[model samples]
Target: MPFPPKANGLFYNSLPPESIYNATPTALEQPFTPKMTVCEERQSLRKRYQFPEEPVDRYVAALSEMAPNCAFGPLENEMVRDQPIEGISSEGIRERLLSIPDFTLEKPLTASQQMEIAKKDAALFSIPDLTAAVQSTESTSFSSFRGTGDLLRPTPPCFRCGRASHLASCSNCHAKHARCRKRDKLGHFAQVCGSVKPSSQHEVVHSVSAVCFTDIRRYHIKTQC
Candidate 1:
């Protein structure tokens, strides 16, 4: 009678019950939270924090940012205080911090104090410009000798025969014992030695003396004629 009760609508029967959609969400289905908790995040940051090659002040600023998120309440100060000592990029600074009579792991300096020491050490000690120093050394080593022309005007004469040029066949060099008083050696004559005393005749002497300064030490080098 009423169109056979509308044939019991197949679409309506196929739909899920309303209660299934309204049921409470399981743990997996709940609103998402970060997998890493505050402690874990803080630990991760601590593990990764290291002294950068930049200025110590920059490192201090970066390290300070981690303090707000720290979960280790009382121990946070110690952690911050020791980070620079343990993770410093500079060995000199690390050693300086370690050498402090009052500084120890059990009784570490305050973060600010540690930072102050680090800044002072950074200012006091610097990596020497070795490349520039080396270039300077090379220049000094190869520089022309002073008063060289005045010492030996007409080119140096040979020590054996007092001539401008000496031949192997020269009898004096081979016959006489070549004694070098300046060098205290017997192989060469004193006249050809770099440290030879000036002769009364103002004879031309080929000698070079170089003075070099290194590490607050002086070195003198002499060359023979």
Candidate 2:
């Protein structure tokens, strides 16, 4: 006896009988309705959609590809209009989108309009403000030049007595020197003083004389009174 006719496999027993095959078309055999297909496509596009870091035109193009047949209803249309404003990586571009004069909730901007504004805003953001840069550079250069000039400038001599390194009030000549006879002022020697009034009738003069006697017998003297 051949082992009591081998038992049917568990998988074979679990499968439906042959009658179920002709009961009705399986889900795979049923042709999907257009609405069902569109719904599935929308769900898939939503899941796969990503806001790229590319230019606004490319971003708009990507959105267009999401619903090529324009099958999205009013709500989805609103989403398509507003997504870039919310999802844009550039704060500047987002602000530009938000600031569109005619882009109210009731009257949303079209893709072409959004693309145009975004392109303009991106261009403006990319350009450097040469006037501001020039002003900043000039300010920095002036500050640096002023600092160096202060460092390199020569220290003036003391005005009172022609001394170096200190102002007249702070110099050693301030107290140590006698009053100038010419100016009748303190803190300076008469010979080295400045800013004194000149006399019209007679001028002050200083003289020095030296005499040496080598041979007394051959010497002659002269005098003026």
Candidate 3:
């Protein structure tokens, strides 16, 4: 398989390393880290990257306990005044979010339910079911059909075996298999109930019939008819 496209990080990381081991520190080398007042740094950082909504009372209280000399800008003062952070509780939001169902997880379905879904999909795709079609219609004769509007059509020979009458339908030739005496795939007899010898020249015709039946079944499957 071809490699997938990688982001810029891959190219940057693929370069050869320059320095290996650390050398003795020179006079120009920087000190480990100069002593710095965190109070001043925090003040400057707060001024530069301040939240638009701040709880003024709580911040003032916190600052009074630490550093009171820090000056806040007008925007910071306004933000602190307009928003009240005293009553904000993350726990409430968490509880509310937990109440909803997560649809991403797989749902359990029984075998029968899955089968029903498959039948529905097959109907949508025009898959044929000969036995069902035959049984569903009120007609006593085989030629008289029913349920012809949509989502159903005539089944190939294979599907007829699946009907309640046949029990799981023949896979070889939809309804036209050797088992089907009406179609006569074996020439002398239907593959389903044929009594003729398999060595006869008619066997070729039967084989071809079987193949045609299978092809027809496949075609019917394509349309879900």
Candidate 4:
């Protein structure tokens, strides 16, 4: 049946284009306020404490990531006051809070006791080991590039060509056209030089030649006759 004509012709029902619930007994009988789930409660809380889209305070962003972790920090007692969010009961929050690790400078025995006893003996509970830890508490070591002896320093780039090479120069640089020392000119090297005399120094030949054929012209005339 429609609403009274005097009131309106419009069907003022909800989602999916219908008032299917109007005739159903189950809908009318059910509780209007349903109990929220744990996730729903958490989401409600997140919306309530939503980080401003463009937050001016840097702490806001940091706090969002570490919100659950805040339970273990000093800030838990000061800045973050717990509010009653449904499904996050006092007992639940306390259990979560207890599980979070609190960093304190107390004796290491408490943490050691929580670990498997076999492993604890190696690092924490033994008097000797504990003493060693205490002694080395102030010791510090730094990470760095390995010592100069440990690494072979890369060779500086060749000046002739701006590239790295091992044997004083690169192959490209070595193959370049070098001036011929023999001819004092470029394009061809000294080994292939066309110079009439070799550029290298030579000893002066001082020994006299003993040639016995001084009548070469007379011998030629007798032969012709």
Candidate 5:
């Protein structure tokens, strides 16, 4: 068999050593490895040396000229006495015959034509008094609360309670993790989580101030002692 590729680590390991040793009676004897062919040796060298592939066939047109197109072509020509004439092409044949129209219409209607027909149909069914009906009377007026930013802004849920409110963080909730009820990522409820920024800076400042005040009071006590 040919030698394995370069990646196979055991290719050179299979070769038996030339050293001779006395065989023990208790030890199992190994069979001697036979000499490999020159082809196998060449194949082993290919793995170690990277050689570019060279095509075995340099020219194929010469071989093609020696052999006929088909085996039966010469045999079939024996019955024919005159030279063969070329037949008419499809374009020439179609030009000679009268064309028959296809039954189906590929395009039912153009985009503009369909749109115009739709507008006419809609107008026929539409109420003539629609404009007056949509308009507001002199006594009646419409007002929208949407214009107010504070009122229009969606209420965010409390971080602790998991309920929708105006608070930045949730309170009065017993949940272990104050994760958002909707996305489950934010510490606050989904409603307010988008708008509520954590007050970590304020809490940090308060803790620092408390620590400083306690240290000053302790120093005063130490001086009195």
Candidate 6:
């Protein structure tokens, strides 16, 4: 006789996307081991339930109360925290949650609470677990490369500079200032104004000017020596 249609659950309606079975290689050239059973089990579990994303902080507290003798250390708390149950089964969840204590905030078992002298057990334990390495690999491979593409691409010219590059690095322009003049403007002193007329024009004369005849060779160096 065939099994009833409802033998499994809602996920059984359609044939699974991939063959549940697959071949595996053995150390020897033996025939491949069938993987259909394993694949189907994973698929069924994936379809049946979802795990909670929130930190199990409250659950942790409850567990501590319930399992005083069970000694879950900081590392254990972290191990539990880092685990992702996104598709865990309800039974699995029950197993996990029931493992914790059954304490709630309002009823802190007066006598038990009194005796428990609630010393804050710091939840700080650093076990260099593989999570960091896994996260680093994921970020560098998936996220960091995508992020870097934008940062390294050349940006449009700055609006302030109106040039094809960084405004701050533009040597062709200067910042607006109270005492500064624009490059094209002659609002400031003449470039030659600081020098005195030579004591004699002869000092200023060039060989090209035969008509110039002042005799003295020098005068005060200029406006401000």
For model 3, the stretches where C-alpha displacement exceeds 4 angstroms are 1-201
Could you give candidate 2's per-residue lDDT for residues 1-225 as a string of tens digits?
Answer: 432333435333444566645533543344463344776766655554335546555665566567654477656656566666765565655676777775643333354456657677877766678756866776666556555545654545555555656655673555346787877977666766654222211121111111112121123211110
Best by the lDDT measure: 2
Write the residue-wise lDDT of candidate 4 on 71-104 in tens digits.
Answer: 4455533232232121222343334434546522
Alpha carbon lDDT at 117, candidate 1: 74
Q: Assess each prediction's global lDDT (C-alpha) against the native.
A: 0.52, 0.53, 0.38, 0.37, 0.37, 0.35
Residue 66 error for model 1, in Å? 1.1
Among all windows of 10 consecutive residues in model 3, the one with the lowest summed lDDT is 103-112
Residue 98 in model 6: shift from native, Å? 24
- By TM-score, is 1 or 6 better? 1
True-structure RMSD, every candidate: 15.3, 22.2, 23.4, 28.5, 32.4, 24.8
Report how far off residue 219 is in candidate 1 (Å): 16
**Cα-based lDDT at residue 41, candidate 1:** 64
lDDT of 2 at 39: 69
Model 1 per-residue lDDT tens digits across residues 7-97: 4354335445655344323332444655667887677656754444465556655666776687768876666666767666666666767
What's the TM-score of every candidate structure?
0.35, 0.36, 0.14, 0.14, 0.15, 0.17
26 Cα displacement, candidate 2 (Å): 29
Report how far residue 95 has shifted in candidate 4, in Å. 49
Candidate 6, TM-score vs. the true structure? Answer: 0.17
- Positional deviation of 15 in candidate 6, in angstroms? 62
Provide the global lDDT of candidate 5 against the true structure.
Answer: 0.37
Q: RMSD of model 3, in Å?
A: 23.4
Candidate 1, residue 110: Cα displacement in angstroms equals 9.5
Q: Could you tell me the lDDT of residue 29 within candidate 3? A: 46
| Poorly placed runs, candidate 2 (over 4 Å) | 1-39, 48-50, 63-146, 149-154, 179-186, 195-225
- Ranked by TM-score, the better of candidates 5 and 6 is 6
Better of 1 and 5 by TM-score: 1
Instruction: Return the TM-score for candidate 1, rounded to 2 decimals.
Output: 0.35
Candidate 6, residues 1-225: lDDT per residue as tens digits? 865668534334333455433321221233354534544643443343333532234433433343323334444443333222342323444344434465332222232232223322322233346657755765555445445543554434323333335432355433211122333432222232223222322332343132211111111122112
How many clashing residue pairs, candidate 4?
0
